[model samples]
Target: MLPQELDGVTLLVDVPLAGLQAGDVGTIVAITRADDGRLRYTIEIERPEGGTADGQLIDLDASQFGLD
Candidate 1:
């Protein structure tokens, strides 16, 4: 079972960018439960060049960051 109070919380993280590129700051927009009973999150990474990248969050634990 999952918690009942993670619907609209903000997630802040500094994730690395693939393909040897520099990373950017990201924010979590949404969180939902998948069909397989796993949690999924939608993240938006904002770059310094006035662009952003959309990414997915898989197997992420909020408690690891003391958010629980």
Candidate 2:
């Protein structure tokens, strides 16, 4: 299900992997809706230590996160 504000929504990661915990927060940078009715989001996961050195831009399905 899509969030009320769509793009730029803050999300809480629901699944843990690759050193990321379940509650990691990310900010959506872009959104795409496919012709087949699938939604994809681009999010920026900033390093908690406050630097861009290890930050990541990840693309995830809508189910990957929850609105914060």
Candidate 3:
């Protein structure tokens, strides 16, 4: 079901991926609506040393994740 209210919101995401540390710069590449009507966000993380890593945001809820 869709969220009852749509409003301004912010979320704090913490990813515990291997070799991922703090201070990494990343940009959101795409935001797509899933089959179940949920939104999926794709982020590209740029390592300071010299490489880039891609990740996906999953299993998010509108209420809990502050997404509307």
**In order, what lDDT does every prediction score?**
0.42, 0.62, 0.43
Winner on lDDT between 2 and 3 is 2
> Candidate 1, residue 3: CA error in Å?
12
Residue runs of model 2 more than 4 Å from their true location after superposition: 4-19, 34-36, 50-54
Candidate 3 residues 1-68, lDDT tens each?
Answer: 33333232233444455344444334444556789888655445545466444342233343333332
TM-score of each: 0.42, 0.59, 0.41
Q: Going through the candidates in order, what is the number of backbone clashes in each? A: 0, 0, 0
- In order of lDDT, best first, we have 2, 3, 1
lDDT of 1 by residue, 1-68 (tens): 44343433333343354311323334555677778877666544334455334343423345322232
Q: Which runs in model 3 stand beyond 4 Å of their true positions?
A: 1-12, 17-23, 51-68
| Deviation (Å) of 67 in candidate 1 | 9.7
Model 2, position 53: C-alpha lDDT score:
27
Q: Which stretch of 10 consecutive residues in model 2 shows the poorest summed lDDT?
A: 3-12
lDDT of each residue in 1-68, candidate 2, tens digit only: 46533344334554344555455667777777877788777777655686542356777777777776
Cα RMSD (Å) per model?
6.2, 3.8, 7.3
